[model samples]
Target: MLLKGKTAIVTGASRGIGKAIALGLAREGAQVVLAARSAVSREGGLEGSIQETAASVEALGGQALPVQCDVTQEESVQAMVQAALAAFGTVDILVNNAGVAFFYPITETPLKRWETVLRVNLTGAFLCARAVLPAMIARKKGSIINISSLAADERDAGTVPTGVAYGVAKAGLDRFTYGLAVEVGQFNIAVNGLKPKEPVDTEGMRFWTKPEERQGWVSADKMVKCALFLAAQDASGVTGTVSTDEELSLWHGL
Candidate 1:
């Protein structure tokens, strides 16, 4: 119950790592706000929904609020934050897990596709962080974890397919995490970036990649310990860095 009596907001929580993190926090006695754009399965076969994630949380005897949010839109982000505050009183943690990835070369990438990738992966994080900061600063305590990816340094990731725009956006997110951490540290709010050490076997990844290519991929649930550790941090503790799950696990001795 590391997070007992705490309230957390997890975006992109319809499925995959986001949903896994939501349940993990709930099991640790934290009330969770599950935010996602998808209320139901879409035509492209994207599965899971915030409603389903909330149901799972309640089944564990935890409090849950399901909100349909489009993080790329500022209004939607602000509304989601207000709903979380109204339901749980205040937010103790925020996991910015909403993202999109494109896996093609710059030459083949359309201008619209590149814009979309950057908007969701980068701008969406900015909007969500801005939406939550006022409350977190007022409380003088909070944790903000930006879910990053190895694509931030795509040059070294020879084993994984990388897209020019996706890499650029994640690289920007890394900077955002560090900058936000510095700005909010004075208010006792910890901000940091987290990425999978290995490719995650998420629903989206499974749909996007060939089955034979997922050999060394890890399950999304393996993220719990590190996420829990970061969620408990502040300026006096770890902050202002981008860490891989493996590194955090070793440092936390989880």
Candidate 2:
């Protein structure tokens, strides 16, 4: 039980990577808060919900709280954190895994779509991190894992299927991980970014990728395991890094 007696908040926990991480933490004995825009799965996506995830956690013998959060809204994010604190006392881990992406050429991409991606992917992480830092700093221990993308590092021109906003936001997230890690290191809080070395077979990925392209994708379990590795580490053990699943697994011998 690597995370026994700990409490964790996982954003966008209705489905995909976020849901997997929530369940994984619970299996390791961490009480979990599942936060997302809805308690039920949205139309036209895979089946999942905050309530469902919470139930899964409870079934694993861990406490669970389901919180409705629109990460793009600071008020919503704050309310979600308050709800978590009311239920769990203090947060030991925060997984900033809520995100959105739409693939389009710059000229073809709508401004609203571009802005929405940035708001959810980058600004949301900022708000959640701010909300948890006070308690974590006071406790002198915490782990923040920012979900990032390999698209942030891809430089081959005109090859990427993802929109510019997605890449830019993830790159910004990586920078945030680095800067925040340095700032909070003195308080013994660890911050880092983690992304799949290969794409995960997530609902979002299914929608965005070609059917044939999905064949080589990794399972959601891989993301969950990688997140566990990050969450279980102490500040001295890991911080201020942006790494892929493969990189982390090799480094930690997972």
Candidate 3:
């Protein structure tokens, strides 16, 4: 019950890591606002929706609000936050988990694809953080966790595969976390980036990896404990840095 009485907004909450975190928050007593690109399951790819996530949250006896949000669009992000505020009074946590990736080579990648990566992975976090900061500052208590990746570091070059935009976007996101944490500390707002220590068995990862080969990948649920710790943070506690799941887990003794 670490998050009792809190209201959290989780973007990209239709499935995978986002969905897992949303449910984890709800279990901890937060009324979660599930934000995703679609209300219903998309026709292709992985099959889950904000509606499904909302249903699960409510099933766990927590209040839920499902919002269709295009994180890349300012208006959409604004509307989503307003919906949360209208329903819950205040936002106590924000999880920037929405993202997109293009794995082809830079030479083969289209301009639109490159822009899309930046918009969703980097700019989307920027927009959502901007939208929620006013409320957090007013309360002088809030946590903003950016779901980042190992690709942010140059040592993880293999993670880039054939493309580069995804890594570039994540790196920018890390910098954003650091800078924002420093700026918002005066208001007691905590901002930090969290990432999986190993490959996660998310829908996208399962698609890219062979079934047998996926045994080593961690489950998306493994992130919840780390996320839970971050969700409880403020300027006085951990903030301003990017941490792996292992780091936060050990730090919190989970």
lDDT of 1 at 12: 94
TM-score (C-alpha) between model 2 and the true structure:
0.96
> Considering only N, C-alpha and C atoms within 3 Å, which residue pairs clash in candidate 1?
none
Please name the candidate that would achieve the greatest TM-score relative to the true structure.
1
Show where candidate 3 strays beyond 4 Å: 154-162
lDDT of each: 0.90, 0.89, 0.90
lDDT of 1 at 101: 83
**Clashes found in each candidate (C-alpha, N, C closer than 3 A):** 0, 0, 0
User: Lowest summed lDDT over 10 consecutive residues: which window, candidate 3?
Assistant: 154-163
Candidate 2 has an lDDT of 0.89
Clashing residue pairs for model 2:
none
Model 3: what TM-score?
0.96
Decide which is better by lDDT, 2 or 3: 3
Residue 92 in candidate 3 has what lDDT? Answer: 91
TM-score for all models, in order of appearance: 0.97, 0.96, 0.96
Query: What's the true lDDT of residue 245 in model 2?
Result: 87
